[model samples]
Target: MERKRGWDTLLSADTHHNAVGLLAREMRRASSPLYYPIALCLLRLLTREKTSWELPAMAFLVEALDCPDMTEWSDSILEILSRRLWSQCTEMHRLVLRGLVLLSKAPGMADGVRSLTPSLVELLCYTGGELVGMVLSVLINQVQDRDIPISTPTALRLAELLPPLFGYDNIHVQLLSIYLFQKVMELAVDKSKQLLKTHVIYSLLPLFFHWHHENQDVAEASRKALLRAAGLLKRRDLVKLLKTEQPWRFSECLLENDKRRAVEYACQALPYLESPQEPVREAALRFIGIAGRYMRGQRVELQVAINVIEDMTPDSAAVKSLALQTQEILRAVQRPQSSPGSSSLKISSRRCRIGRLLSGAAAGGQRRTYSGNPV
Candidate 1:
């Protein structure tokens, strides 16, 4: 019961790690009910005021896992742990994640895990390698075994962050990010399903591109995510196409229903023209062509797509043909030149922003390709 007296060594000594960790470890196995006070003592030391003490506190906390009463402190443990997952201190943050990982397995921890969605999604933007793998494994835990409802705001942020990761070099990241996205679609609050509609709409073409991924798992994940997206958008026709494995018609169906965003969708599809995989390039080129049909007066967006397509040097003859075919499709439909008296060609600020973004992505792709890295 006097466990608090031994806690000072955690903050003051370089030698306490082994002793504290060992004591915490042995406490978990002791016959008497002594672990809780020790665990509670460790938890109180996890504050920012004692930066030196935080890691030891978390380390001892982890060593005490499976202690008979661990779950009783879950909410507090989760609260403190969730706040530290973003710690700038690398080892501290990792220990926090490891603690959360163990804490998450206990019953009734779903709400705590659900609150973690935004943090994990945000972390995906900044971390990679083993850190990314760790964050993703924890994120996968968040959505599995039960429905962990995410807020509309979190869904919106996640929807934005997840698409770019569809091509992450790490196969695990690529796979987990896509799978988690589908759960976001399924478990987001019902009313926000409509709010998530626009994001879902934007994801269709990219998901379709990855559907041809060489990695069977990634391809399957993309397909499943696209299916969930279609269901969320209430596009039964598109759903039937995906369910039936008819990707060729899926792009056309998607554009036919949402023709208005053709310009936006086409811009999003432009960068995939440089994809190392021929099938992805071919899929992107094909979709851009169909999307071109809907771009009659979208002269600015049309020419932007053409400029990027012109940079494509085909890996296969079919890609070359599709490139030209798409060129012709876009060329034939571009609105005629302004009348003689017309002022400068007016472009929307929105289109200008899209143009800049596509150009930046294409440039990034080239730089990374030259360096043999994933953008």
Candidate 2:
């Protein structure tokens, strides 16, 4: 029984290869925490000089991943396990993520993962650039696979992990995080919309607006994350966060150094400004004006502007004009406004009609009239 301090029977080469069956049998026991240490031992074996066992270790992990009780295992143990594996994780990243994806698909896993979510969130903050990107990518895929809702602490944990990642010295991690976060927002459940207001995501503004040291890839990632989060939540508080967080300084930075991303992030916020509070509307319009000016000729930026305008109130001659102009610009790229654009225009016009009727009524009277509005 003389064993290494960090090593256990599950790590023994002979036993570790057989761990899937061992862990599976124990999985059904009442004291589920027992498997936590066992899982950690397997993780350690995988990270150590035990190449002969890689496939079997992965198989073991895959099995544990399938076990219904896996998430109920201890948080400290999982953290230790992930930390040990972080540097040496290699191709295991996909496997671990795939495992988590499978676990998430199990009807009861979220409830279990919920208990250890704080630990999982902490892991997001601990790893280096590449490892963090791998972790987030895995989590995103699993979330998509399981159709996990965004309001859960687990989802927010994943969101909060992205901003700091913008500072990561690696361009690939930054780009990967940006790409995955966009997909995550697009795939998130509609009911989780209100959770988007949480300040965890608000912290990203500084990175989006002021981080001059970052390269285009980092800047692009920051831009995409802000846009995606804004589109999902539609909260003006995000605007205030950017402003109050550092207005004069950020303005100077954007003006002097990196206007492209600032413009992109601002353009993304415009669609959410439809009938917003005066301050929010003012801020959004200001950003759109700046973004629009810079975005004029570039085909991609122009396309984004067109999309923003299409999503806005059609009654505003300003919004309508911008959209119409965008159509003309897009025409040079290909052909005149296509079906998607025309359909959006029709839908936006109807929204504007509803808005005018409400605006014409006294504020309090209109409140009573549309109190039952589903939205």
Locate the minimum summed-lDDT window of 10 residues in model 1. Answer: 366-375
Residue 245 of model 2, lDDT score: 41
User: What does the lDDT read for residue 133 in candidate 2?
Assistant: 59
**Residue-by-residue lDDT tens digits, candidate 1, 55-170:** 66777787766565667777777878777778897767777777767666766776777677777778978987667767777766876876768778887888888878888778
**lDDT of prediction 2:** 0.48
- Identify the runs in model 1 with alpha carbons over 4 angstroms from their true place: 1-69, 72-76, 115-121, 313-318, 334-375
Which of the numbered candidates is closest to the native, going by highest lDDT? 1
RMSD of 1: 9.8
Each prediction's RMSD over C-alphas, in Å, is: 9.8, 16.8
Using TM-score as the measure, the top candidate is 1
